[model samples]
Target: MTPETSAKLAETVDNCRRHAGDWELGITLMLRTHVTIDLTGGLPSVDADLAELHEIADRVGDRWTRAQVASAAGEVALSRGRYDWARAEYEECLRLAREVGAHTEVPFAIARIAESAFCSGDFDGAEQLLAEVAREVEPYGGVYDVRAYGGMLAALLALVRGDLERARAECELARAASEMIAAPPQLTAGLDNIDAVLTARAHGPEVGLAKLGPTLAAAVAAHCAERVLASLCDTAAVLLAAAGRSAEAVRVLAAATAWRAGHPRSVPEQAAVGGLPDGTRAVLGPDRYEQEAAAGAELSPAEVVTLLTGS
Candidate 1:
């Protein structure tokens, strides 16, 4: 956020504080906090925001604010790579939001829970959850937000199942949804990173890295959660290695692993360390691979950026 926007939000927060226990003000702030988390990918500043919102949720008698707090907490859980915990929070959010009204968050909670299932490798469970969300959301005029994120998950499922054509169609839907909403880069890049993986598999990693490298850097620049960027870099490194760029790939993984050390939140993605593939380990041989990764771990962010950009 710009200095001016930051100041304005701060002032608005204070104004909301003045109206303590006011349902309208509390609800509004909670909504804004949720949007802020979505836009900025739950940066550290919102740690305090969620903390305060939780306290406010307990004090406020309104179910709407309580629902919003659960929803916002769900986003924080996602940022921290706690997928199961996130699913629980979203389930609570759905329940609470329903108690207040047929809020759109109800559908979003289901979609996100399905996403957690998808990431957890429970394809059958994810499909069931996604179907449930679709059934619920279709009747409510279909919130584009759910479609945007949900479409991406659909595409991911397609990719894992080797259905490239289905993946392509789902990715198109996801991109269209993003365009419809004019979502920020932080959100859109999730689709892009996944698309890069698909492209790398079909064509080549050189093709994938061309897009993934820059997109990953941009996401990191936006201060998105380390998990978000870590996942992207993990797949990007695989692409690079596939393109016969194992040396560079090792460096990328090493740098990404080191960067992730500061954030210390890792999703359960079938990787031994830093999300690098076991196949990559097999190809590089442990000794040489570890050496390059060690060297990469020592590089500064600027240096990593230089390597990613090939500058």
Candidate 2:
């Protein structure tokens, strides 16, 4: 469902809570609604829903519900870049899911743990967890989360290791899996970001920018996830910096940073900072770069989109 619809449903559910079961439904809906990347700020914080979930679990002594709560918490922590906490929560979710015969959640929990490892830069750990997810889901023709999310993580890990062929294969797997599930536009945008980065590395910045420009514009217009949007901006910045368009790089980077500051749960700032080339700083000089960045930060979303799309 769209984030807007989910937010509306969550609000309606919240007002109709008349019993413990209703509380559980309301809290789950609210958690799912608010945790979505696009509509986070209008609803209650995820922590409040999680706390209520925990209370519900304690009252009912339901291991399955507890496992669900852990998984939800893990997702929240991961989105906020708390890797260790996310891993711990996912592990608890896995353990409890197994105890409660929540078989469907097992592979998903493992995939998320792998995600935490990937995000934390522990590639080997991510591989191990992903392998476990593969084993768990293989008997069932593979789960969508394991295939799509895990494939994306694996592709990125392969890229970091400079294994272009493997990265391409994994990216294709992710793309196919995403298509099978008819994944959200934000997710497809993430796949596009990955593809653009790979293309930049293999071909040229101009070629990559040609592919990325439309996808980036569409993502911004769709109000995609902040993490996906940030990655797209960083990739654009990197490509621009590589192509010697240092001014454009600085503007995109600065606009992305400004946008992220308003959306606090986004990927960390350093992720974007590290993508730009050192030459960008030298080309503009530190003072001029900062001045341009400050100016760029004030650009409205429409202005930023126009700048990025060059239209």
> Which candidate leads the pack in lDDT?
2
Error of 2 at 216 (Å): 2.0
Question: Which regions in candidate 2 have their CA more than 4 angstroms from the true location?
Answer: 1-7, 19-27, 38-44, 262-278
The whole-model lDDT of each prediction reads: 0.72, 0.74
TM-score of 1: 0.85
Could you say which candidate leads in TM-score?
2
**Which stretches of candidate 1 lie above 4 Å from their native place?**
19-43, 262-268, 271-288, 298-305
**lDDT of candidate 2 over 1-311, digit per residue (tens):** 46677677677666656544744574555456344534323223556667776777677677777777788778777766688898999999999999988777798899988888877778798889888988888888856856887788788778777898998999999999987886867667878878998898889998999888888778767766556666677778878888888988888787776666543432323554574635677899999888878887776556756776678
> What local lDDT score does residue 25 receive in model 2, on the 0 to 100 scale?
77
**Model 1, 97-204: lDDT tens per residue?**
788786677778888888777766678888888778777778777588788888888887777787899988989987888887867666677888888877877777
Query: CA shift at 281, candidate 2, in angstroms?
Result: 1.8
